[model samples]
Target: QEVVKRTPGEAEFHQAVREVIDSLGPVLVKYPEFGEAKIIRRICEPERQLIFRVAWQDDKGEVHINRGLRVQFNSALGPYKGGLRFHPSVYLGIIKFLGFEQIFKNALTGLPMGGAKGGSDFDPKGKSDNEVMRFCQSFMTELWRIIGEHTDVPAGDIGVGGREIGYLFGQYKRLTNKFEAGVITGKGLNYGGAQVRTEATGYGCVYFVNEMLASRKEGFKGKKVVISGSGNVAIYTHEKVTQLGGKVMAMSDSNGVIYDKHGINLDTVKLLKEVQRRRLKDYREYHRSAQYTPNGNIWDIPCDVAFPSATENEITGKDAKKLVKNGCIAVGEGANM
Candidate 1:
């Protein structure tokens, strides 16, 4: 109630706070000092929040404007570290919610990193390479003032990937006249990025799920998996699951779902999504047996395990019920969802 009152219209942030508060009963009871010192309250509020203007010119010489955001939620552990997402759905509430989640995520790793998130509502889907570069340059013009290797370090998320990161890093270097490779992660290997960083999130998720299944004397050797989203996480997740002997029956994009009975071909998916940036519907051209359903409910497909590796709040109550009814034995989240 207090969260909602303080941050009206920020439903995602409110829900994030409520989720943490609701889970703290045991910790509050055991420590009591945390509550007495108002640590929870401090954690709920961001250390700093910056919303800025990102104005760039399109190919047609028309100027477009977008709002960029960075919420330095907490730095109790160390410097702020998080990804910068570029999506039309991004807002203050979504970034706050993501930053809130990042605090615990970093803490769990016991890494000397804090929590922060930065992004803009810019959609880079149809933009040309030069247009994307101009946008990154304009964005970094303002962003460079606040970020550094020892301060907040931003990486790629969703619409922002290696291409975006390269452009952003180039702009950062050009602005500061310094080649500080440590200022960002997920850079191309020719730059300073660590190898396997691109596959880390997806591979790690599968490894974590493997451990969970091991606890129950089960594994992915013969499981049928359904992963939502055809982006980085989903693509690599499909790769790792297939390597682990699981048959990934379906994968989806925002527009539709692709169902392949024999299993999805990662090579073809990589070509279509990564290189060409085409839709899932084009997948049928490569594999005749593959079925593409436009705007279909992926949850309706039966599977042994489900990976909601898409956006947040994608799996609603009804979706959960449908998955259970379809005999989904486990669920592992590979995205913010």
Candidate 2:
């Protein structure tokens, strides 16, 4: 209640807080000292929040401006570490929501890293290489002052990927005049990126789900799967699931969903999304037997397992009902949703 009152209009953040607080009831009862120290209140507040203006010129010599945000939620364990998003949907509320979730996520790993999440409302979908470069440079110009190898290290998220990270890192090096490779993650392997980093999240999600299925004395072999989103997480999830003998029947993007009865071709998906940055609808060009539905709900499809790897709140009550009605035995989340 206090969180909502304090951060009015931030529905995501409020929901995140409520979820966490509700879960902590038993813990609070077990350890009243935590409540006595007001730890819960402190945890609800971010240590620092940075918001700035990112201005750059487009290819047409037109100036475009966007808001950049960084919420350093906590650093009790170690330095601040999180991903930098670049989707137009990014805002303080979503950033805070994600960062708050990160606090628990990092803690679960038992790693010496804190929680933070930063991003801008800039959409990189249609931007040219030069335009993206310029926007990244401008975004980093303000971002670099507060981030460092030992302070806040950011990785890729959503609209921010290898290309955007390269531009941001280049600008950071230019500003600081130091080859601080540890200042960021998800760099190109030639520079300092770790191998398996690109496939880790997606692969890990499938691996975790495989274990969950194992608990029920089942596996991914011959299981029909439907994954939402064709981005990094969904693409690799499909690949790993297929390698484990699961058939991925559907994958989606923001525009629509693609259903392929013969199983989705990961190679074609990579070509369209990773190489060409095209929409999932173009998938029909390669697989003539596949079906494409514009703005369709992937949950409508029948599957043994469903993976929501797209944006937040993508699976609604109706979608959940349909998935349950379609015989979906399991649902794994590969995105923050």
Candidate 3:
């Protein structure tokens, strides 16, 4: 309550803190030393928050400016590590919320990386390749000064992906005159990108769900699954689920969901999305029988497993009810919240 009152206008951040605190009553009771040290209060405050102006030109040569931020929330574990999301909804509140959560998530991973997040309210959708390149270069011009592999490594998230990473890394290399591959994680394969990194998130999610199911003596083989989002995580999740013999019935994007009862054609989807950078509606172009539903109920579609691989808060109470009603037994979140 005090945090919410103090940080007015950061509704998301406030909610995140409240949820975390509510779940930690047992921890505080067991570890009085942590409570006495005011660890929660200290973690609420960020060590450094950088906000700057990012100006870039579209193909029309018109200049536009947006705000960029990097909230280094905590470095208790190690160097600040997180992703850079490019979306119109990004702001201080969202960044703070993500950074705060990353602190605990990193600790759980048993990795040396700490917690931080940076982003801008720059929508990449409908932008031309050249325009996106210009934006990434301009964004990285200022970002390169503060980021290093050993200091803070930023990767892709949301609207940012391989193309954006390539542009950002190229700009960073031009400015620093060094081929430091460690400065970023999601680079092109020819440029020191990690092996299987493209599908790691989705694969990790599938592996996690498999473990959960195995504990109950079940598996994805022959199970029906529906995944939201057509991005890297969602596409790869679909691929892995199909490989595991599960039928992926549908996938979605901001525009809408793509339903294919006969199972999604992963090859066409990958070509359309990853290579062509087209929208979900284009999926029907290749598969004549595939259905494209704009603003339809993705959860209403029946499935044994559901992967919310899209943005945050996409699945509402109504969607949850529909999923439960339709007998969705498992759900894996590929998106970081």
Candidate 4:
């Protein structure tokens, strides 16, 4: 395990990695076979971590330089697999957490994949489509050399979606001149994307919850569910819950949450998220009766089931207590914790 501390600023991330490694030492010693196989020690560190400078010109013709990283953690089972996140909050600590979690999650899937994660701290919220494409192209220009179909495969995460992936894949293909289908996942359907890939995560959560309910002799029929976050996961989770006969009472984002006690209109929620790409605050304008609580807590609202499909740590122990007190029977987590 090679531990390279880039600078004093990366202390937090380094400390986190050290803590995780320390915790795993006991487990490694307990499983003598794993120690003999060197699996635990081998899994404690990333195989490779590439940090590069990305320079791109903004629409205003101003040159901006951003740091990018691709952490190919391990490939013990198969090729490295994870998502590429692009957000202002991205950093070494966040990426490392996601990458470490991916290692175990991929193993649980019974898939032949190891673990990796990459991204930058570039916010795409207000940027034009052209600007986003340009940035992605520039980012991929450097990233392509380090990744391939059998090397490390990256998919979509917080800020990287279809548009970003399209720009990235185009750049990769242009540079390598290789039409590799398996090099990336979460691609457009017309271009070798698997069916139900888009809705897989969100829908899978709903399906698991349904099974849990069935096991307990209960189902989603007429149940009131509260979903936080209006992104792809939240939107699709809302859709699936509705399909299962549950009425989604609310959905939220960073701006706020909108509660429709009369039952959430799935079509309207879709319009706000999919078509408009707007915040949940705008939902109240269309439906006057829907209560829009700006910057308010979604867990405060009463519901039967709670799905915190937003970012990590959004639902803390405090929020969990509130949900349990509010009669929340089941809680679903979508993001990497």
Q: Per-residue lDDT tens digits of candidate 4, residues 1-337?
A: 2443433465444555676677787787778788788675566567888888888888998888888989898898899999999988888777877787788889899989999999999887877788888899999999999888899999998878788888899898999999888888888988877888888889989999998888889999988999888777887898899899999999888778899978878788788766666777788778889999889999999888888898877887898899999899998887655
Give the winner by lDDT: 3 or 4: 3
lDDT of 2 by residue, 1-337 (tens): 8888899999999888888898999999999999999999999999999999999999989998899999999999998999999998899999999999998998999989999999999999988999999999999999999899899999999988899999999999999999999999999999999999999999999999999999999999989999999989998999999999999999998889999999999999999988998888899999999999999988999999999998788789999888889899898999984
Cα-based TM-score, every candidate: 0.98, 0.99, 0.97, 0.91
The clash numbers for all candidates, in the given order, read 0, 0, 0, 0
* lDDT (0 to 1) per candidate: 0.92, 0.94, 0.90, 0.84
Best by TM-score: 2
What's the TM for model 3?
Answer: 0.97
User: Over the stretch 1-337, how does candidate 1's per-residue lDDT look in tens digits?
Assistant: 8778888999888888898899999999999999899998899899999999999999999999999999999989988999999999999999999999999998999888999999999998879889989998899999998889898889989899899999999999998999999999999999999999999989999998989999999999999999999999999999999999999999999889999999989999999988998888899999999999999988999999999998888789999999999999889899984
Clash-forming residue pairs, model 1: none
C-alpha RMSD values across all candidates: 1.1, 0.8, 1.2, 2.9
Local distance difference test, candidate 1 = 0.92
* Top-scoring candidate (lDDT): 2
| lDDT, residue 290, model 3 | 93
Over 3-69, each residue of candidate 3 has an lDDT whose tens digit, in order, gives 8877899977987898899999999999999989999899999889999899999999899999998
Ranking by lDDT: 2, 1, 3, 4
**What stretches of model 1 exceed 4 Å from their correct place?**
none
